[model samples]
Target: MTGRSDEYPAAPKAARRNRGFEAASRLLRERIRTAGESRGFAVSRLLTHWPEVVGEEIARMSRPVKVGYGRNGFGATLTLLVEGAAAPIVDMSREQIRAKVNACYGYNAISRVVLTQTAATGFEDGQAVFLHSPKPKPAPSPEVQAAARATAEGCADDTLRQALERLAENVLARSAARAAQKKG
Candidate 1:
């Protein structure tokens, strides 16, 4: 009150600096790690990047459920939820699966893989969804594209014409694929 007015003290320079918004992933990383740990996944990459850790073929038929560590914490067993029909196929590739999972951790973290077979519809434990990255659609053939362009040539607007051409190409390609399947 002597010389200065009754204004509140200024915030520290570090706190005053405008640190822009943070990404959702960055903000939730620790929470995600904690949740993954509760599910016995020490390294979250195995769950997040399962398709990349294992080949697409394996990932398509299986999903990592949990990791059960030994009493000594030396050899962990990875449990995979697999479709009933694919269980045998996955069992045959157990060693390969173990190797791939261990490689993902950069260590021999998983000693074995145990398969839990379930119906295609999955179980009631809220693990029913088994999804993977979609396979990329093949490019339409040159012939199909040319035909589509020809069909769309009557359209007046350039953008509309291009969109129509894409639609025609997709329809024609799908028909061609069906025809080929019938022939085979």
Candidate 2:
């Protein structure tokens, strides 16, 4: 037993091979649930689907912040961070937003929307929260470049041909880098 790798039981293997790695969204959900005290989870979902739940016009102007649960443990009030001067329009559309959000949840989840207005252009602020750094992709290795040229040789359009060549190079380089990371 002392010499065995299985001397102590490791965490259980998934029942089916190659099928049990959790999606990144699942981890995000668990974090949201734990941090939100239940109310936050729905709020996060609303934020994620905001563009779909509310129309683009409203979504661009407002963002769901916190959910205040009533004594009934249902019929919650949603607090939204909004752009300045747009609160009136956003407030006016609350009923429509609520309908769309409830439709997203497949039932009634938000009873009212509370707006807190900030800058007139909320786009930059909202984008910062979700965007990763915009670092440019590195140049591909010589092997990848050759492969890309070979792959694009059949393309007829000069512009399309160049675009396909670049895509091939990027894809190959990205895959190679990922493999290297796994190996390391």
Q: How many residue pairs of model 1 clash at the backbone?
A: 0
The all-Cα superposition gives candidate 2 an RMSD in Å to the true structure of 15.0
Ten contiguous residues minimizing lDDT sum, candidate 2: 121-130
TM-score of every prediction relative to native: 0.59, 0.49
* Residue lDDT tens for model 2, 114-134: 887775344446542435778
The digit string of per-residue lDDT tens for model 1 on 11-75 reads 66764536688789889999989999998999999999999999999999999989999899898
Q: What is the C-alpha lDDT of each candidate?
A: 0.90, 0.79
Best candidate according to lDDT:
1
